[model samples]
Target: MQRQTLRLLSSTASIVFSVLATQASAQMFNSVQLHAAAPGQSGGMLGVAALSTPEYQGSAKNRKLIVPVVDYQWANGWFAGGSNGLGYNFSGDPKFHYGVRMTGDIGRKEKRAKLLRGLGDIDAKPEIGAFFTFNPGADTYFASSVRYGAGNDNKGMLFDLSAGFTESWNRNLSAGASLGASYANDNYMQSFFGISQVQSARSSHKIYTPKAGLKNTYVSAFVSYMINDRTSLSLIVTSDRLAGDAKSSPLSEKTRTSSIVAAAAYHF
Candidate 1:
Protein backbone atom coordinates (compact mmCIF):
# COMPACT_ATOMS: atom_id res chain seq x y z
CA MET A 1 0.00 0.00 0.00
CA GLN A 2 1.19 3.54 -0.84
CA ARG A 3 0.19 6.10 1.74
CA GLN A 4 1.03 9.67 2.80
CA THR A 5 0.11 11.61 5.93
CA LEU A 6 0.61 15.24 6.81
CA ARG A 7 -0.72 18.17 8.84
CA LEU A 8 -2.10 21.11 6.86
CA LEU A 9 -2.50 24.70 8.01
CA SER A 10 -5.52 26.59 6.73
CA SER A 11 -6.49 30.27 7.12
CA THR A 12 -9.16 32.48 5.65
CA ALA A 13 -9.23 36.19 4.97
CA SER A 14 -11.98 38.63 4.12
CA ILE A 15 -11.81 41.14 1.28
CA VAL A 16 -14.45 43.73 0.36
CA PHE A 17 -15.39 43.94 -3.28
CA SER A 18 -17.84 46.07 -5.18
CA VAL A 19 -18.85 43.53 -7.78
CA LEU A 20 -18.62 40.18 -6.01
CA ALA A 21 -19.90 38.54 -2.84
CA THR A 22 -18.48 35.53 -1.06
CA GLN A 23 -20.55 32.43 -0.41
CA ALA A 24 -20.86 31.52 3.23
CA SER A 25 -20.37 27.80 2.82
CA ALA A 26 -17.76 25.73 1.09
CA GLN A 27 -18.52 22.33 -0.41
CA MET A 28 -15.92 19.60 -0.90
CA PHE A 29 -15.63 18.25 -4.40
CA ASN A 30 -13.27 15.88 -6.26
CA SER A 31 -9.69 16.47 -5.14
CA VAL A 32 -8.21 13.65 -7.20
CA GLN A 33 -9.55 14.53 -10.59
CA LEU A 34 -7.65 13.78 -13.78
CA HIS A 35 -7.78 17.34 -15.04
CA ALA A 36 -7.96 19.37 -11.86
CA ALA A 37 -8.58 19.00 -8.16
CA ALA A 38 -11.88 19.98 -6.49
CA PRO A 39 -13.01 23.59 -6.48
CA GLY A 40 -10.89 25.40 -3.95
CA GLN A 41 -11.99 27.41 -0.94
CA SER A 42 -10.70 30.73 0.29
CA GLY A 43 -7.88 29.44 2.43
CA GLY A 44 -4.35 28.06 2.53
CA MET A 45 -2.76 24.70 3.32
CA LEU A 46 0.58 22.92 3.67
CA GLY A 47 1.26 19.19 3.90
CA VAL A 48 3.51 16.31 2.91
CA ALA A 49 2.63 13.94 0.04
CA ALA A 50 3.80 10.80 -1.75
CA LEU A 51 2.83 9.82 -5.30
CA SER A 52 3.60 6.61 -7.17
CA THR A 53 3.73 6.73 -10.94
CA PRO A 54 5.60 5.34 -13.93
CA GLU A 55 9.03 6.76 -14.59
CA TYR A 56 7.64 7.74 -17.92
CA GLN A 57 4.08 7.23 -19.18
CA GLY A 58 4.66 3.59 -20.14
CA SER A 59 7.89 2.47 -18.58
CA ALA A 60 7.75 -0.41 -16.12
CA LYS A 61 9.84 1.44 -13.58
CA ASN A 62 7.87 3.12 -10.82
CA ARG A 63 9.01 6.28 -9.11
CA LYS A 64 7.65 7.47 -5.82
CA LEU A 65 7.36 11.27 -5.48
CA ILE A 66 7.74 12.59 -1.96
CA VAL A 67 7.16 16.33 -1.78
CA PRO A 68 5.60 19.09 0.22
CA VAL A 69 2.03 20.13 -0.65
CA VAL A 70 1.03 23.77 -0.44
CA ASP A 71 -1.96 25.75 -1.70
CA TYR A 72 -3.81 29.04 -1.30
CA GLN A 73 -6.93 30.66 -2.66
CA TRP A 74 -8.74 33.99 -2.34
CA ALA A 75 -12.44 34.58 -1.99
CA ASN A 76 -12.42 36.72 -5.11
CA GLY A 77 -11.83 33.55 -7.23
CA TRP A 78 -8.09 34.03 -7.68
CA PHE A 79 -5.83 31.10 -6.76
CA ALA A 80 -2.17 30.37 -7.06
CA GLY A 81 0.50 27.84 -6.05
CA GLY A 82 0.29 24.01 -5.97
CA SER A 83 0.71 21.01 -8.30
CA ASN A 84 -2.40 22.24 -10.18
CA GLY A 85 -0.87 25.62 -11.18
CA LEU A 86 -2.85 28.89 -11.11
CA GLY A 87 -6.16 30.27 -12.38
CA TYR A 88 -9.24 32.34 -11.59
CA ASN A 89 -12.98 31.85 -11.65
CA PHE A 90 -14.69 34.76 -13.36
CA SER A 91 -18.26 33.57 -13.96
CA GLY A 92 -20.73 30.84 -13.04
CA ASP A 93 -24.35 29.76 -12.68
CA PRO A 94 -26.45 27.57 -10.41
CA LYS A 95 -25.20 24.51 -12.28
CA PHE A 96 -21.72 25.45 -13.40
CA HIS A 97 -18.56 27.40 -12.64
CA TYR A 98 -16.29 28.73 -15.36
CA GLY A 99 -12.59 29.15 -14.73
CA VAL A 100 -9.12 28.90 -16.20
CA ARG A 101 -6.10 27.06 -14.81
CA MET A 102 -2.71 25.57 -15.65
CA THR A 103 -0.70 22.48 -14.79
CA GLY A 104 2.90 21.40 -15.17
CA ASP A 105 3.64 18.92 -17.90
CA ILE A 106 6.52 16.81 -16.61
CA GLY A 107 7.89 15.55 -19.87
CA ARG A 108 9.91 12.39 -20.50
CA LYS A 109 13.32 11.69 -18.98
CA GLU A 110 14.44 8.13 -19.46
CA LYS A 111 17.81 6.62 -18.74
CA ARG A 112 19.30 3.12 -19.08
CA ALA A 113 17.30 2.48 -22.23
CA LYS A 114 19.63 1.50 -25.06
CA LEU A 115 16.70 1.78 -27.47
CA LEU A 116 16.05 5.41 -26.52
CA ARG A 117 19.51 6.86 -26.93
CA GLY A 118 19.77 10.01 -29.07
CA LEU A 119 16.00 10.51 -28.77
CA GLY A 120 16.97 13.44 -26.54
CA ASP A 121 14.57 14.64 -23.93
CA ILE A 122 11.21 16.37 -23.87
CA ASP A 123 11.61 19.21 -21.42
CA ALA A 124 9.02 19.85 -18.76
CA LYS A 125 6.52 22.57 -19.67
CA PRO A 126 3.39 24.35 -18.53
CA GLU A 127 -0.11 23.74 -19.90
CA ILE A 128 -2.65 26.55 -19.54
CA GLY A 129 -6.34 26.49 -20.31
CA ALA A 130 -9.91 26.89 -19.13
CA PHE A 131 -12.49 24.57 -17.59
CA PHE A 132 -16.18 24.24 -16.77
CA THR A 133 -17.94 22.15 -14.16
CA PHE A 134 -21.58 21.13 -14.22
CA ASN A 135 -23.39 20.08 -11.10
CA PRO A 136 -26.50 18.25 -12.20
CA GLY A 137 -27.70 17.33 -8.70
CA ALA A 138 -26.48 16.69 -5.21
CA ASP A 139 -24.65 13.51 -6.09
CA THR A 140 -23.43 13.85 -9.65
CA TYR A 141 -21.26 16.21 -11.70
CA PHE A 142 -19.52 16.55 -15.05
CA ALA A 143 -16.47 18.56 -16.13
CA SER A 144 -14.43 19.38 -19.22
CA SER A 145 -11.20 21.29 -19.84
CA VAL A 146 -8.82 22.17 -22.64
CA ARG A 147 -5.21 23.21 -22.17
CA TYR A 148 -2.45 24.23 -24.53
CA GLY A 149 1.26 24.07 -24.04
CA ALA A 150 2.68 27.45 -23.07
CA GLY A 151 6.38 26.66 -23.24
CA ASN A 152 8.86 25.66 -25.91
CA ASP A 153 8.98 22.07 -24.69
CA ASN A 154 5.91 21.06 -26.70
CA LYS A 155 3.35 23.02 -28.66
CA GLY A 156 0.32 20.78 -28.67
CA MET A 157 -3.03 21.13 -26.98
CA LEU A 158 -5.01 18.61 -24.92
CA PHE A 159 -8.69 18.06 -24.15
CA ASP A 160 -10.04 16.35 -21.06
CA LEU A 161 -13.62 15.21 -20.40
CA SER A 162 -14.85 13.57 -17.23
CA ALA A 163 -17.88 12.68 -15.10
CA GLY A 164 -18.35 11.45 -11.59
CA PHE A 165 -20.95 10.49 -8.96
CA THR A 166 -20.76 10.45 -5.22
CA GLU A 167 -22.48 8.41 -2.52
CA SER A 168 -22.85 9.26 1.12
CA TRP A 169 -22.11 6.10 3.02
CA ASN A 170 -22.51 7.65 6.44
CA ARG A 171 -22.53 11.01 8.19
CA ASN A 172 -18.75 11.46 7.94
CA LEU A 173 -17.85 9.14 5.10
CA SER A 174 -18.45 9.36 1.36
CA ALA A 175 -17.27 7.54 -1.76
CA GLY A 176 -17.07 8.65 -5.36
CA ALA A 177 -16.13 7.21 -8.73
CA SER A 178 -15.08 8.97 -11.91
CA LEU A 179 -14.40 8.16 -15.56
CA GLY A 180 -12.41 10.30 -17.98
CA ALA A 181 -10.63 10.47 -21.30
CA SER A 182 -7.90 12.73 -22.68
CA TYR A 183 -7.24 13.70 -26.28
CA ALA A 184 -4.01 15.04 -27.74
CA ASN A 185 -3.14 16.98 -30.88
CA ASP A 186 -0.75 15.90 -33.64
CA ASN A 187 2.18 17.85 -32.22
CA TYR A 188 1.73 16.18 -28.85
CA MET A 189 1.40 12.75 -30.46
CA GLN A 190 4.48 13.30 -32.55
CA SER A 191 6.48 14.70 -29.69
CA PHE A 192 5.78 11.97 -27.17
CA PHE A 193 4.84 8.89 -29.17
CA GLY A 194 6.23 9.32 -32.65
CA ILE A 195 9.68 8.15 -33.66
CA SER A 196 11.63 10.09 -36.21
CA GLN A 197 14.16 8.84 -38.78
CA VAL A 198 16.96 10.48 -36.83
CA GLN A 199 15.79 8.68 -33.73
CA SER A 200 15.50 5.39 -35.57
CA ALA A 201 19.10 5.57 -36.76
CA ARG A 202 20.17 5.66 -33.11
CA SER A 203 17.72 3.15 -31.63
CA SER A 204 16.51 -0.41 -31.95
CA HIS A 205 12.99 0.62 -33.00
CA LYS A 206 11.92 1.59 -36.46
CA ILE A 207 10.90 5.13 -37.36
CA TYR A 208 7.25 5.87 -36.86
CA THR A 209 4.92 8.88 -36.72
CA PRO A 210 1.54 9.00 -35.03
CA LYS A 211 -1.61 11.00 -35.63
CA ALA A 212 -3.61 12.99 -33.11
CA GLY A 213 -6.19 10.98 -31.18
CA LEU A 214 -7.34 9.78 -27.80
CA LYS A 215 -4.32 9.47 -25.58
CA ASN A 216 -5.77 7.56 -22.65
CA THR A 217 -8.87 6.52 -20.77
CA TYR A 218 -8.99 6.30 -17.01
CA VAL A 219 -11.20 5.63 -13.96
CA SER A 220 -10.72 6.56 -10.35
CA ALA A 221 -12.49 5.94 -7.04
CA PHE A 222 -12.05 7.74 -3.77
CA VAL A 223 -13.43 7.63 -0.25
CA SER A 224 -13.20 10.58 2.10
CA TYR A 225 -14.02 10.85 5.78
CA MET A 226 -14.33 13.94 7.88
CA ILE A 227 -12.44 13.37 11.08
CA ASN A 228 -13.57 16.57 12.74
CA ASP A 229 -14.59 20.14 12.00
CA ARG A 230 -11.08 20.94 10.82
CA THR A 231 -9.67 17.67 9.50
CA SER A 232 -10.41 14.98 6.92
CA LEU A 233 -8.86 11.94 5.26
CA SER A 234 -9.16 10.56 1.75
CA LEU A 235 -8.08 7.46 -0.16
CA ILE A 236 -7.98 7.34 -3.95
CA VAL A 237 -7.38 4.54 -6.42
CA THR A 238 -6.82 5.20 -10.10
CA SER A 239 -6.08 3.20 -13.23
CA ASP A 240 -5.38 4.28 -16.80
CA ARG A 241 -4.41 2.80 -20.15
CA LEU A 242 -3.06 4.27 -23.35
CA ALA A 243 -5.22 4.36 -26.48
CA GLY A 244 -4.83 5.06 -30.20
CA ASP A 245 -1.27 5.71 -31.36
CA ALA A 246 -0.15 6.14 -27.80
CA LYS A 247 -0.73 2.44 -27.20
CA SER A 248 1.09 1.41 -30.35
CA SER A 249 4.20 3.46 -29.71
CA PRO A 250 7.38 1.44 -29.78
CA LEU A 251 8.40 3.11 -26.55
CA SER A 252 5.24 2.10 -24.76
CA GLU A 253 5.15 -0.67 -22.22
CA LYS A 254 1.46 -1.10 -23.08
CA THR A 255 0.49 -1.96 -19.50
CA ARG A 256 -2.23 -0.38 -17.44
CA THR A 257 -0.98 2.25 -15.03
CA SER A 258 -2.44 2.19 -11.53
CA SER A 259 -1.92 4.37 -8.48
CA ILE A 260 -3.11 4.68 -4.89
CA VAL A 261 -3.08 7.95 -2.95
CA ALA A 262 -3.97 8.53 0.67
CA ALA A 263 -4.37 12.13 1.83
CA ALA A 264 -5.12 13.93 5.07
CA ALA A 265 -6.26 17.53 4.91
CA TYR A 266 -7.32 20.26 7.31
CA HIS A 267 -9.76 23.11 6.79
CA PHE A 268 -10.13 26.42 8.58
Candidate 2:
Protein backbone atom coordinates (compact mmCIF):
# COMPACT_ATOMS: atom_id res chain seq x y z
CA MET A 1 0.00 0.00 0.00
CA GLN A 2 2.87 2.42 0.61
CA ARG A 3 4.05 1.87 -2.93
CA GLN A 4 0.55 2.41 -4.29
CA THR A 5 0.32 5.64 -2.35
CA LEU A 6 3.42 6.98 -4.06
CA ARG A 7 2.00 6.14 -7.48
CA LEU A 8 -0.86 8.52 -6.86
CA LEU A 9 1.60 11.35 -6.38
CA SER A 10 3.19 10.70 -9.77
CA SER A 11 -0.21 10.67 -11.46
CA THR A 12 -1.18 14.11 -10.24
CA ALA A 13 2.11 15.95 -9.90
CA SER A 14 1.41 18.09 -12.97
CA ILE A 15 -2.10 19.40 -12.42
CA VAL A 16 -1.78 23.20 -12.41
CA PHE A 17 -5.32 24.37 -12.83
CA SER A 18 -8.14 22.34 -11.36
CA VAL A 19 -8.47 19.59 -8.80
CA LEU A 20 -10.08 17.29 -11.34
CA ALA A 21 -8.49 17.45 -14.81
CA THR A 22 -5.16 18.37 -16.30
CA GLN A 23 -6.49 20.15 -19.34
CA ALA A 24 -9.44 22.48 -19.68
CA SER A 25 -11.36 20.43 -22.24
CA ALA A 26 -13.24 17.29 -21.31
CA GLN A 27 -11.38 17.09 -18.02
CA MET A 28 -8.28 15.67 -19.69
CA PHE A 29 -5.58 14.36 -17.36
CA ASN A 30 -1.93 13.43 -17.08
CA SER A 31 -0.83 10.18 -18.70
CA VAL A 32 -0.94 8.19 -15.48
CA GLN A 33 -4.43 8.01 -14.00
CA LEU A 34 -6.17 6.69 -10.90
CA HIS A 35 -6.64 3.20 -12.35
CA ALA A 36 -3.18 1.65 -11.84
CA ALA A 37 -3.63 0.52 -8.26
CA ALA A 38 -2.99 -3.19 -7.69
CA PRO A 39 -6.17 -5.12 -8.52
CA GLY A 40 -8.33 -6.24 -5.61
CA GLN A 41 -6.33 -3.87 -3.41
CA SER A 42 -9.15 -1.39 -3.60
CA GLY A 43 -9.02 1.70 -1.45
CA GLY A 44 -10.34 5.25 -1.37
CA MET A 45 -9.20 8.83 -0.65
CA LEU A 46 -10.94 11.89 0.76
CA GLY A 47 -9.44 15.37 0.93
CA VAL A 48 -9.60 18.95 -0.29
CA ALA A 49 -7.29 21.04 -2.45
CA ALA A 50 -6.79 24.56 -3.68
CA LEU A 51 -6.28 25.48 -7.34
CA SER A 52 -4.78 28.59 -8.91
CA THR A 53 -5.56 28.98 -12.58
CA PRO A 54 -6.02 31.48 -15.37
CA GLU A 55 -9.46 33.01 -15.47
CA TYR A 56 -9.90 31.13 -18.68
CA GLN A 57 -7.47 29.12 -20.80
CA GLY A 58 -5.71 32.15 -22.28
CA SER A 59 -6.73 35.14 -20.26
CA ALA A 60 -4.13 37.18 -18.43
CA LYS A 61 -6.14 36.80 -15.26
CA ASN A 62 -6.16 34.26 -12.47
CA ARG A 63 -8.69 32.80 -10.11
CA LYS A 64 -8.51 30.54 -7.09
CA LEU A 65 -10.73 27.61 -6.24
CA ILE A 66 -11.20 25.26 -3.34
CA VAL A 67 -12.12 21.80 -4.54
CA PRO A 68 -12.88 18.47 -2.97
CA VAL A 69 -10.67 15.48 -3.63
CA VAL A 70 -12.31 12.09 -3.82
CA ASP A 71 -11.23 8.88 -5.54
CA TYR A 72 -11.94 5.23 -5.04
CA GLN A 73 -11.76 1.83 -6.65
CA TRP A 74 -13.54 -1.44 -5.92
CA ALA A 75 -12.00 -4.88 -5.93
CA ASN A 76 -13.95 -5.70 -9.09
CA GLY A 77 -12.32 -3.01 -11.32
CA TRP A 78 -15.08 -0.46 -11.12
CA PHE A 79 -13.80 3.02 -10.21
CA ALA A 80 -15.11 6.52 -9.79
CA GLY A 81 -14.00 9.95 -8.64
CA GLY A 82 -11.99 12.91 -9.91
CA SER A 83 -9.63 12.00 -12.76
CA ASN A 84 -10.80 8.42 -13.04
CA GLY A 85 -14.35 9.57 -13.65
CA LEU A 86 -16.65 6.54 -13.68
CA GLY A 87 -14.80 3.82 -15.49
CA TYR A 88 -14.08 0.12 -15.53
CA ASN A 89 -10.64 -1.40 -15.37
CA PHE A 90 -10.33 -4.29 -17.80
CA SER A 91 -6.65 -4.95 -18.29
CA GLY A 92 -5.78 -8.48 -17.33
CA ASP A 93 -2.12 -7.59 -16.90
CA PRO A 94 -1.12 -6.18 -13.55
CA LYS A 95 1.26 -3.68 -15.16
CA PHE A 96 -1.34 -1.92 -17.28
CA HIS A 97 -5.06 -1.18 -17.83
CA TYR A 98 -7.42 -0.38 -20.72
CA GLY A 99 -11.05 0.58 -20.32
CA VAL A 100 -13.84 3.01 -21.13
CA ARG A 101 -14.93 6.00 -19.08
CA MET A 102 -17.51 8.75 -18.75
CA THR A 103 -16.11 12.22 -18.05
CA GLY A 104 -17.27 15.81 -18.34
CA ASP A 105 -15.99 19.24 -19.30
CA ILE A 106 -16.25 22.33 -17.19
CA GLY A 107 -16.99 24.65 -20.07
CA ARG A 108 -15.92 28.27 -20.13
CA LYS A 109 -18.24 31.04 -19.09
CA GLU A 110 -17.82 34.52 -20.58
CA LYS A 111 -18.85 36.16 -17.36
CA ARG A 112 -15.90 34.68 -15.52
CA ALA A 113 -13.78 37.61 -16.62
CA LYS A 114 -14.10 40.95 -18.38
CA LEU A 115 -11.78 39.90 -21.18
CA LEU A 116 -14.47 37.46 -22.34
CA ARG A 117 -17.27 40.03 -22.59
CA GLY A 118 -18.38 39.19 -26.11
CA LEU A 119 -17.77 35.47 -26.12
CA GLY A 120 -20.82 33.49 -25.10
CA ASP A 121 -20.94 30.87 -22.45
CA ILE A 122 -19.77 27.40 -23.29
CA ASP A 123 -22.00 24.89 -21.59
CA ALA A 124 -20.47 21.97 -19.77
CA LYS A 125 -20.90 18.66 -21.56
CA PRO A 126 -20.70 15.01 -20.63
CA GLU A 127 -18.21 12.86 -22.48
CA ILE A 128 -17.36 9.28 -23.35
CA GLY A 129 -13.87 8.01 -24.06
CA ALA A 130 -11.27 5.28 -23.80
CA PHE A 131 -8.10 5.07 -21.70
CA PHE A 132 -4.95 2.98 -22.13
CA THR A 133 -1.93 2.79 -19.84
CA PHE A 134 1.22 0.72 -19.75
CA ASN A 135 4.02 0.43 -17.23
CA PRO A 136 7.21 -0.88 -18.76
CA GLY A 137 8.84 -1.04 -15.36
CA ALA A 138 7.84 -0.38 -11.79
CA ASP A 139 9.04 3.22 -12.11
CA THR A 140 8.03 4.11 -15.66
CA TYR A 141 4.58 4.52 -17.24
CA PHE A 142 3.00 5.58 -20.53
CA ALA A 143 -0.60 6.68 -20.95
CA SER A 144 -3.00 7.98 -23.61
CA SER A 145 -6.71 8.74 -23.85
CA VAL A 146 -9.31 10.35 -26.11
CA ARG A 147 -12.68 11.87 -25.27
CA TYR A 148 -15.68 13.21 -27.21
CA GLY A 149 -18.90 15.18 -26.68
CA ALA A 150 -17.64 18.58 -25.52
CA GLY A 151 -18.57 22.06 -26.81
CA ASN A 152 -21.93 23.58 -27.69
CA ASP A 153 -22.89 21.02 -30.29
CA ASN A 154 -21.40 18.31 -28.16
CA LYS A 155 -19.27 17.25 -31.09
CA GLY A 156 -15.89 18.33 -29.81
CA MET A 157 -13.12 15.81 -29.37
CA LEU A 158 -9.79 15.83 -27.52
CA PHE A 159 -6.86 13.46 -27.29
CA ASP A 160 -4.34 13.47 -24.46
CA LEU A 161 -1.03 11.60 -24.26
CA SER A 162 1.57 11.42 -21.50
CA ALA A 163 4.45 9.52 -19.90
CA GLY A 164 5.75 9.54 -16.34
CA PHE A 165 8.70 8.44 -14.16
CA THR A 166 8.74 7.99 -10.41
CA GLU A 167 11.17 7.42 -7.56
CA SER A 168 11.12 6.80 -3.83
CA TRP A 169 13.83 8.61 -1.86
CA ASN A 170 12.92 6.62 1.22
CA ARG A 171 9.99 4.83 2.85
CA ASN A 172 8.32 8.17 3.54
CA LEU A 173 9.56 10.46 0.76
CA SER A 174 8.68 10.04 -2.90
CA ALA A 175 8.87 12.02 -6.13
CA GLY A 176 7.79 11.80 -9.76
CA ALA A 177 7.69 13.71 -13.03
CA SER A 178 5.66 13.48 -16.23
CA LEU A 179 5.49 14.91 -19.77
CA GLY A 180 2.34 15.15 -21.88
CA ALA A 181 0.56 16.69 -24.86
CA SER A 182 -2.98 17.51 -25.96
CA TYR A 183 -4.78 17.55 -29.32
CA ALA A 184 -8.04 19.15 -30.28
CA ASN A 185 -10.45 18.45 -33.13
CA ASP A 186 -12.04 20.99 -35.43
CA ASN A 187 -15.17 21.45 -33.37
CA TYR A 188 -13.24 21.71 -30.16
CA MET A 189 -10.79 24.22 -31.60
CA GLN A 190 -13.43 26.40 -33.12
CA SER A 191 -15.48 26.45 -29.96
CA PHE A 192 -12.70 27.56 -27.65
CA PHE A 193 -10.07 29.25 -29.83
CA GLY A 194 -11.90 30.44 -32.92
CA ILE A 195 -14.28 33.33 -32.98
CA SER A 196 -17.13 33.55 -35.48
CA GLN A 197 -18.11 36.67 -37.36
CA VAL A 198 -21.25 37.11 -35.27
CA GLN A 199 -19.15 36.73 -32.19
CA SER A 200 -16.59 39.17 -33.56
CA ALA A 201 -19.30 41.76 -33.94
CA ARG A 202 -20.29 41.34 -30.33
CA SER A 203 -16.89 40.97 -28.74
CA SER A 204 -13.71 43.02 -28.58
CA HIS A 205 -11.80 40.74 -30.88
CA LYS A 206 -12.15 40.12 -34.59
CA ILE A 207 -13.39 36.97 -36.28
CA TYR A 208 -10.72 34.32 -36.15
CA THR A 209 -11.15 30.70 -37.03
CA PRO A 210 -8.52 28.15 -36.12
CA LYS A 211 -8.26 24.64 -37.49
CA ALA A 212 -7.84 21.50 -35.48
CA GLY A 213 -4.33 20.58 -34.40
CA LEU A 214 -1.99 20.20 -31.46
CA LYS A 215 -3.11 22.36 -28.60
CA ASN A 216 -0.52 22.22 -25.82
CA THR A 217 2.50 20.47 -24.34
CA TYR A 218 3.22 20.23 -20.64
CA VAL A 219 5.38 18.78 -17.85
CA SER A 220 4.76 18.15 -14.15
CA ALA A 221 6.78 17.23 -11.07
CA PHE A 222 5.94 16.50 -7.49
CA VAL A 223 7.31 15.60 -4.07
CA SER A 224 5.24 13.92 -1.42
CA TYR A 225 5.83 12.95 2.22
CA MET A 226 4.02 10.19 4.02
CA ILE A 227 3.01 11.17 7.52
CA ASN A 228 1.98 7.61 8.22
CA ASP A 229 0.40 4.73 6.29
CA ARG A 230 -2.97 6.42 6.00
CA THR A 231 -2.00 10.05 5.36
CA SER A 232 0.30 11.99 3.05
CA LEU A 233 1.14 15.55 2.03
CA SER A 234 2.22 16.73 -1.43
CA LEU A 235 3.46 19.70 -3.40
CA ILE A 236 2.89 19.68 -7.15
CA VAL A 237 4.07 21.97 -9.90
CA THR A 238 3.06 21.90 -13.55
CA SER A 239 4.03 24.01 -16.53
CA ASP A 240 2.32 24.10 -19.93
CA ARG A 241 2.92 25.89 -23.19
CA LEU A 242 0.36 26.51 -25.89
CA ALA A 243 1.19 25.30 -29.37
CA GLY A 244 -0.34 25.18 -32.86
CA ASP A 245 -3.92 26.34 -32.96
CA ALA A 246 -4.21 27.16 -29.31
CA LYS A 247 -1.14 29.31 -29.53
CA SER A 248 -2.13 31.15 -32.70
CA SER A 249 -5.61 31.88 -31.47
CA PRO A 250 -6.39 35.46 -30.50
CA LEU A 251 -7.95 34.24 -27.29
CA SER A 252 -4.59 33.14 -25.94
CA GLU A 253 -3.15 35.78 -23.66
CA LYS A 254 -0.24 33.99 -22.04
CA THR A 255 1.01 31.16 -24.18
CA ARG A 256 3.04 29.62 -21.38
CA THR A 257 2.15 29.45 -17.71
CA SER A 258 2.67 27.33 -14.59
CA SER A 259 0.56 26.04 -11.72
CA ILE A 260 1.38 25.09 -8.16
CA VAL A 261 -0.78 22.97 -5.91
CA ALA A 262 -0.57 21.43 -2.46
CA ALA A 263 -2.85 18.81 -0.97
CA ALA A 264 -3.19 16.29 1.81
CA ALA A 265 -4.72 12.92 1.01
CA TYR A 266 -5.72 10.03 3.21
CA HIS A 267 -6.11 6.44 2.12
CA PHE A 268 -8.72 4.10 3.54
Highest lDDT scorer: 2
Q: Which regions of candidate 2 fall more than 4 Å away from where they truly are? A: 1-5, 8-27, 30-32, 35-37
| lDDT digits (tens) for residues 87-172 of candidate 2 | 88787675787899887788888898776788899998898988898878666878898889988789988898888787988877
Which ranges in model 1 have alpha carbons more than 4 Å from their true place?
Answer: 1-41, 92-94, 112-115, 150-153
* Collision count for each candidate, in order: 0, 0
Q: What's the TM-score of every candidate structure? A: 0.78, 0.92
Clashing pairs in 2: none
The Cα error of candidate 2 at residue 70, in Å, is 0.3
> Cα lDDT for residue 35, model 1?
17
lDDT per residue, candidate 1, 26-131, as tens digits? 0011111211122433665544445565556655655565555455566667666553347776743435757878765656544634445678777767777887
List the RMSD of every prediction in angstroms.
9.1, 2.3
